[model samples]
Target: MNETKAATASTPGTHAHTGMTTRHDTWWLAPLLVATGFTLFIVYATFRAFENNYYEIGSIISPFYSPKIDLPGWPFSPAILILWMPAGFRATCYYYRKAYYRAYFLTPPACGVSVWGSKSYTGERAFPFVLQNLHRYFFYLAVLVLTILWYDVFKSMLEPSFHFDLVTLIMTVNCVLLSGYTFGCHAYRHLAGGGLNCFSTNESTKQRFKVWEFVTKLNEHHMAWAWFSLFSVGFTDFYIRQVCAGVFPNPVFF
Candidate 1:
């Protein structure tokens, strides 16, 4: 019975290795890994912001505004960051993937008559590219965030009690960074274009349209601000995090 069992096990296609599955062969691995990296960077920035007590609005030494908010505390290891990276928002990568696939991959190889594997005579514009819609929403959010951050800067400058220090300097820089990010966003560019055809119909609207035209010229380099603002945001958040962590000194330039 033992010999027969051994022979059966040794037979071709009869036995399979039961090892752990690896992520190596997965098609989604690249995008998944990129998403994970983004999450970690944001989380680290959040942790540093909390450490510096960035959430505290009124005073330097006070606790953060949100009692429920929790970011991993430091002398934090990278392993902890990596493990926590997959916690949420698996859908974000789809946005990034689709945007890039069109901008970089799909558009390049497309041919005039060839229609990119689609049916002949079908119009792509009829479907109206959905990913482009995100630029508008992101633009509005950028403007909102920039306004808030700038308000914080103004508020800080207005405070007589704070005195001139590192916190104030950082806040000022943060405001500038946020503006760069907001102005650089793709949607902001569109708005700057004076392309709101319906908005231009009125005599009064024409005056505002001229201003938008002027600003749109600056906004035309959408990609420039996109990258600059992206990095600046990370830097601003990093500075705030450092202030929270007590690892860095908070400056207040009054």
Candidate 2:
């Protein structure tokens, strides 16, 4: 028994003494993929936001420019006004925080892998990390933004003449994916019923529990929805931009 205890205690320290690392294969690949995908998205989004034009065509508005607020004498992109809220929301997303921290910061790039930061790690309690507490507030603002996006989707369907075009279909699908991403938010699930002490104590609480369960299921695949929505929104903007630029005519089906 004494030998077993001594061996167990010494095993963990052996890695540090010998400079040994994780045993997992391909540990670096996931973070590399995440970094590549996120970097491309940031570059593309920055370019589109600055371009400003081709954001609207007929009734189809780019997701980047939905609920467009024209600020008189404002020098920067109009997309700034609408984009900031969602941008903040996504930046503070729980899943995204884990992703960027791993991919960009190399904070234990993968499970079983060695962490790459300083020995002193103060997570989510210092300087910038403390700001993540604002995610819930961002969630509220995102709900409003999502409402406007859905309105855009409906408006796209109600063009003067009844016709379905590639842009229209893309915008509609974008809304759906965005909805999945937004509604599946961990903050939203908590808001639904996470604070309740007992679900059976009250009818209202029980009802909220049901809603919470549904949101929980959605939250399980939040990562998938997050990536899908990101690509879908960017593609929606690109499609609208291309069509508006006359690079390609919108194929319509009535």
Candidate 3:
């Protein structure tokens, strides 16, 4: 009886470890690193922009920084920060709770620390694990914001005399980066989750759900998209800085 119990327990443990290894061993880590690096770079760039006396977004009355473009208000900076927050958090979704509880919270694992440091058992306030909940809300916001940014791009294009400068090119690249990031959101996968019966028990929802499921399969791999999107954002900002400093021309893509 004792021997049988030991064998059964060990079998499941082995399988669990194997599954984790398989998931983490894929090309996932590379993209994750890339995304993390990009996210850091963008944060640094934004800080630099403020430090370089370009923080104001078209408030002519303020004696702080002069306005470059006629921006509405303090909209630009806040929007950028808000939009990137989800991207930043989502990047760590793979094993975030474990990292937090281990690194800061100093919680112990039920089974043992897997890999470097992870508790086998989750804590009482499992609510944070509900980080999963942010996916859908962020998805809608990301999509909406991307559409608005694209509109800004169109507005930029309208001015024929506006120099096809590097700053403008960077803005265009930023749009693309945002789109990729938004499309790759986890909630997007849920939104794409097939087999819905909320509206009607017919094929309409089913068919759409099927399409969403395919997209979700791609979105299911959130870590990859997260990193890819991060890199693109950093590159976009870099391009913007180069243009702003007169280092490059913003050539329009044909």
Candidate 4:
């Protein structure tokens, strides 16, 4: 053990004995921005979930409140009943795990940086971290929620007579962006056909291969989809709140 320590200590590219890279570039900037953006989103989402009142305006219910459910005798926000599905899905997302692990936990911080636990480190094999495996289950739940959200968006355009408005456009874009993100999930890509050993096993397998290919295309841009969808959903909620508060004008073109 002493000899191994001596060798590690002798390594010159990283700081002595600490294993951290001695990069002179702005490597810290990425983590700083990621942490800041995540913090802002969390704070905004929490406030909106608890506030709950301005989430519904006519057929244009905010993404935060679609398929609205409030338990009997429940005193808190209805969003409590709805937010968990998407929130859990995002929290356990494969890409997001990398983001938070680096930014929040400083576990490597960036691609080449050495983490505090680089030695004897086990990735997601421990207690709390093991819960990340539930990402697949969360994907299932999020799909159900996304279905409801799509319905809500169409309802907004059709209900109380057909009309197109700024709110409708915003909600539509939010749902589309979210669909791209959710369908591009690593769990979803695997579910699409990752288990199959051959794509030409039969007619059914051939069709499944097509789905897998489509999902693969989306997965190529999963990171972009993830960020865009997040912004869209948050903006949808904010715009709805503004309309509810009479602070923003939502013009309709019928």
Candidate 5:
């Protein structure tokens, strides 16, 4: 009886050692953490997007509301417009797709775990998954948005008196994190020179090769930058909102 039960448990297609029955210790922890963190960010961002009143303070604009476009007759939040590009870029991001797919969809949630959905895995070959191929295009838009945010950061540092402030420092840090993530993107690394057939043939290609190497180093820690930038952007927005709402006072230091 014991031998029969053991054999049945080890049989393929039984899922007796996979899915909820995974034998690997702490295998479920990673996906659970990812799901919790991602969900919290989504909820906070959604609330902030609709509650747009506290997005600006004096000369500083919240990261969430940069490049503000006010349409006199528009019915919805302007944030929706500015956010859509970054959101799309992130949605199509290679690392993010893996994280969310595991966390949210439970598609093979973790290593050694049985895959969810149908028995046959048709990965990215179908309708919505095909859209991930647009990541490169989204990377272009992300660069445009990053440029705008950097401009905002510079503006935040400029006061009539030339003194550094808390918001200025915060914006600077946010810009650095965001730039790290954006520049470290896989598409950006490819564009830098990953596609080159011959790096030694020309000086220009050599320079591009050097740049690609740097970006490649950055890519090694892309997942860390992704989470850091995600948190930084939201925190920056929240700080700006607090200042705008008179909930917190902005401090200055020379």
Candidate 6:
């Protein structure tokens, strides 16, 4: 009877005024900015992804529409063939999940801030969120796509014959930033050596520990990498698309 009564009793939340936090400053700024930036990118990327034109120029192809797959009867954009890999990888990214969760969902937008109508949480064991476990598999696919991106960049050399252009530099920088963000992932860090309690086990373990150390350094700035790469990739596609659209010529130099 006591247990039932206790369970049925309603209790108020933490003490303090101003909605679970006494903070009077502009605490909502970060999430608001994040939401705005991500929303803009979503709109831009969606338009670019679906429009299916100007995504390629000479040897440069937008990251969104890579590999250039063509099926005999498929009547949709070729991006649907490969874009899902990178999309899935980013969607399941640990840093991105936290980012969108706070910015978009506003499930307690910030530390000590509370959202109305929220219930007790049992972690990501719930539906939809549990799908995040696929991050590791997506990490493997990300690596594969990264390799292909490198191949595309190399093609820039052969097509234009050992010359460099603004697009090449942009593509290279974007690839580097994407690589940093990807290698810094928590899932990738775990693969470097998560379960191992001891790094002194043997030479192999020592090697993995070194890799883990590198990934840890990258993970420390994972958020920064995420943002930079996001901008870089988006700009890369935009610049290439503009060049393809005859808005401007891609300045080339040998």
Clashing pairs in 3: 109-119, 165-250, 166-250
Instruction: Kindly list the per-residue Cα lDDT of model 6 for residues 1-254, writing each as its tens digit.
Output: 24332222211232222234445677689888889988998899888878989988778898888888888998888877887898899889998888787788665566656543345544589888898999999999999988888888889867868878888888899999999999999999999988998999999999999999999999999999999998998998898899999996788877
| Model 6: CA > 4 A from native | 1-20
TM-score of each: 0.49, 0.90, 0.56, 0.91, 0.91, 0.90
Tens digit of per-residue lDDT, candidate 1, span 52-73: 4344544331111212234566
Q: Which segments of candidate 4 are over 4 A away from where they belong?
A: 1-19, 117-120
- Candidate 2, 35-62: lDDT as tens digits: 9999999999999999989888788788
- In the order shown, what is each candidate's alpha-carbon RMSD? 14.7, 4.2, 8.1, 4.2, 3.8, 5.4
Task: In model 5, state the lDDT of residue 154.
Answer: 75
The lDDT values for all models are: 0.44, 0.83, 0.47, 0.85, 0.84, 0.82
lDDT of 5 by residue, 46-152 (tens): 99989978998767998887889998998888898799888998899999999988888766676546555444455787888999999999999999999999988
Judged by lDDT against the true structure, how good is candidate 4?
Answer: 0.85
What are the clashing pairs of model 5? none
Which scores greater on lDDT, model 3 or model 6? 6
Best by the lDDT measure:
4
TM-score order, best first, reads: 5, 4, 2, 6, 3, 1
- The residue ranges of model 3 lying beyond 4 angstroms of the native Cα positions read 1-39, 42-120, 123-132, 160-174, 194-203, 220-222, 252-254
Q: If both were scored by lDDT, which would come out higher, candidate 3 or candidate 5?
A: 5
Worst 10 residues of 3 by lDDT: 58-67
lDDT comparing candidate 2 with the true structure: 0.83
Worst 10 residues of 4 by lDDT: 10-19
Task: Return the candidate ranking by lDDT, descending.
Answer: 4, 5, 2, 6, 3, 1
lDDT of 4 at 5: 46
